[model samples]
Target: MNVFVSEVRQLIDRHLPHYVQSLQAEPRLKEAMCYSLEAGGKRVRPLLLMAVLEAYGKPISIGLEAACAIEMVHTYSLIHDDLPAMDDDDYRRGQLTNHKMYDEATAILAGDALLTHSFGLIADAETTEMTAEIKVALISIFSKAIGAPGMVGGQLADMLAEKKSLTVDELAHIHRRKTGDLLTFSIVAGAYIAGVNKEDRLCLEQFGQELGLVFQIKDDILDVESDSETLGKPVGSDETNYKSTYPGLLGLDGAKKMLSYHHEQAKGYLHKLGLSDTILGEIADYLVERLH
Candidate 1:
């Protein structure tokens, strides 16, 4: 891993689990929320936020609250996504899925708690420099990213696309919302916190779009080529669920090509933003090249 990524990951890992602990919520609920938060996935969303902050020469502390909020939303999505009514996965990050670790009801409540508290975390952020305007903007973008028009809407579309064929554009639409929007939010959030100009923020949004494609396409490739142990989740589950994927739609080689194309596009956007030599560049490479 890059030294910068390692540092940010460590910062997130150390603090993420504790946020839910101090909530005035039920003990079991907090335990379940903490259980999934600590499961230790890539932490990619938060990393993107902080990395973009660093790229803009802003303090990482300026974005930490929003980073955690983004992560909590992500983790909640995963927990709910693993429910029996959804993907029905037994494991994630090499541990039992939340529903399996505790129970379905507890898992549901835990996700809800995390999702609701995330906004509060940002609103009440202890960052002395953050203003009400920034908090409100973050909350607005965030709700849209993970809510009806974004992740949830995309998820519904994904489920409906199962066992059916879709064109490249159609598949992109689903992944754009289900996966891309939140990733875009992560980068854009940093730009907002960094007080970047409109043109620069636009550059980051474009960069994030390409990176999101790289991530989802690589994920599709991994499902076919990697193992359950390597992924820390079941392999070939996409096929089993009859979901449309870049690999399924374009074939493995074709998917690789798409991934490569997006990776390059992201680099172009970074160059456009004058961030080609920064940690954002490293993160872009890591996202597409990662094994899991």
Candidate 2:
């Protein structure tokens, strides 16, 4: 593993434990919040942001607050997603999901708290060296990404499509907004804080979008081909929910082909960025190779 990856992982692990403890609540509610927040997963999104910063020669200190904020937003989404009203999943990361482990109201509140707390985390980060304009822009980008026009909108679209056949375009739109927006934000956020120029930022944004799409498509394919033990959630849940995905719409072989094409496209964009970094190459490879 890359040293940066290990360090970033440790940073997240260390901060998350204490961060969860700061969730002021009644004892039982506190436990419920801690349960899901502590659940293990790949931490791909936040790590991607941190890696982008490292690749651009920014100190981890500059990106630490943004990295944790990304995770907080991600965890909040997962909590709400597993609720009965959303994906209705009973398990996540190979354990009982928030709603399954706690009452529905507690799960809902926990998700809400995490989402609302993310902004405070960002605002409180010591950003003395960062210009006020840049910090405000970053906050705006993240806020919009998590709001109705972004993840929440995509989720609503997904819910509307459940049990009903959807066109390939529809599936792409949903996942692009649901997953791609935040993933794009990761790259853009890192690049912005690193002071990359506008043209390079545009290229990186495109790269991140393609990467995020590939990530989601591969996930759908794995849902069809991998067992629950590897996936950390029920395999075929998309099919179980009758939700549309790349695999559900295009067949396994077709989805794999799409993934390969997008993976290569993402690499092509990365090459255009002119940055020399082992982490970027390793990340691209890992995105294609990861089983979960």
Candidate 3:
């Protein structure tokens, strides 16, 4: 699993700079885009996509383009999320956010470039070895996952829910769209590329959903327990923003319990897919245990 993670991280690191450099027409925009893309991260979304491909006996090359595409979308979301009108965060991954390092307009334009360029990358003939039909399907999935009914809707709900009391179900609804949809797409996109059996694909989708919940719950717990230096962002920002969180609704102990429950559920889905002892299994564990 360590080797797999290392390989994917290296693959992304080597290629991401080239992608940013392609935007030479607007040097400042390219700089802002590259700044966040180059910033160190776990690259969990792309890793999950490639890992699913590897596990299904598909060549990792087949999914690398899609992985990059998804990472672009994820990074774009972070840039916008940190804007003054949004999360208003000053730092990300221990460095000034794009909006902070550059200007707000530059940051917004950089994000827009990343989001649009991702689709172009996916559609480019040189990007992947998949068929035209497969590429189209992947693009459709990618668009919908990040579009109104998915990540965008969730973000809108999250923003609207601020300073308002929410039921546990309502909070879950917000996250299921906001975070879960994209994570689910990451795994399922690989499955589609690999042409995995429908049953296994469904299992992976379930695992992604469970893993997303575990991720958000762990994040909330970390915000309470971790320091800013360790987290690379401010702690208690959720409180400051009056956003709904698992910990806030469930209490620290209840949130921890929920995390454990989802961890088990994610593992169970992997077991159902006959991947209980694979790197995907280890990833499930790692997601729950990771502090940042």
Candidate 4:
């Protein structure tokens, strides 16, 4: 856990409760929903969104709702991904997964609610000081990133690929959609809100996609090497399902080398942007170093 991620987790903890509490539905069900939201996962995407905003000399407060919206989408994906029809996991973030803690139907509803509610959160964001065009751009970017051509399509490909052999390029494509798309939005949303020019925003998009590919490779490596207790989910599940992964296709040593290559590429982009912020560097380092 890096210090910056720790700080971001604290920010989420402080802000998310008020937002959830205000949702005010069936108190028990809503409480369960909040439980899943506040269960202390790594708030990685949200932190990246905020950090990118900060890197552009913008206040994090300007993107707080957007940041939290990203988390909501991430959380919803995890909950559904853990469903019996999906990954069928029993644990997450060192706790019972939503389906295991609550019932499957409740978990389904929770995920659905989170996804829809995320849009509402973004819509209700206090952008009074921002121009209308910037706000509209933020909304468009977030929607497209999480919609049909992005995360949803990626998830479908991932499901279809289970127990199947895929070329390195195919695997990369699936990962880009499944994981990279939302991450791209994370960077783009921040930059769009901060009025970054189109060319600069494109650079950030490239950075996000490259960084996302590295992140997924590292995640696959962790699935091979990390313990179930440490991972809070079944380890070696990729092997169990006969799925292709970096380690499966490239071998552990080869995968490590490939990860190094992606990391260098991403670092090169960040350097071109003249970023001195150690947070972005640390994120890159964390993505590569966490597999062990």
Best by lDDT: 1
Write candidate 1's Cα lDDT for 1-292 as tens digits: 3777788888888778888887787899999999999998788998899888888888898788888888999999999999999888888889999999999999999999989999999998877657898889888988998999999999899888889999999999999999999999999999999898899998899998888888899999999999888888779988887888899889899999999999999999998888899988998998887889
**Number of the candidate with higher lDDT, 1 or 4:** 1
Better of 1 and 2 by TM-score: 1
Q: Model 1: clashing residue pairs?
A: none
**lDDT (C-alpha, whole model) for all candidates:** 0.90, 0.82, 0.87, 0.83
Model 4 spans with C-alpha error above 4 angstroms: 1-3, 128-130, 276-278
Best TM-score among the predictions, by candidate number: 1
TM-score of 4: 0.94
Tens-digit lDDT track of model 4 for 92-156: 87788998998998999888888888888887888663566766777787777887788888888
Please give the lDDT score at residue 145 for candidate 3: 86
Q: Per-residue lDDT of 1-292 in model 2, one digit per residue for the tens?
A: 4676778888887886576677676777667766876798577777787777777877767877777888888888999988997788888888999988888999999888878777777777786645678778889999888788889898898888788888887888889889889989988888888888899989989989899888899889889999988888788887877778898788889999999999988988888886534486578778889888
In angstroms, give how far residue 264 of model 3 lies from its true place: 1.0
Cα-based RMSD of the predictions, in order?
1.1, 1.6, 1.3, 1.8
| Model 1: CA > 4 A from native | none
True-structure RMSD for candidate 4: 1.8
User: How many clashing residue pairs, candidate 2?
Assistant: 0
Clashes of 3: 0
Candidate 2 lDDT for residue 74: 87
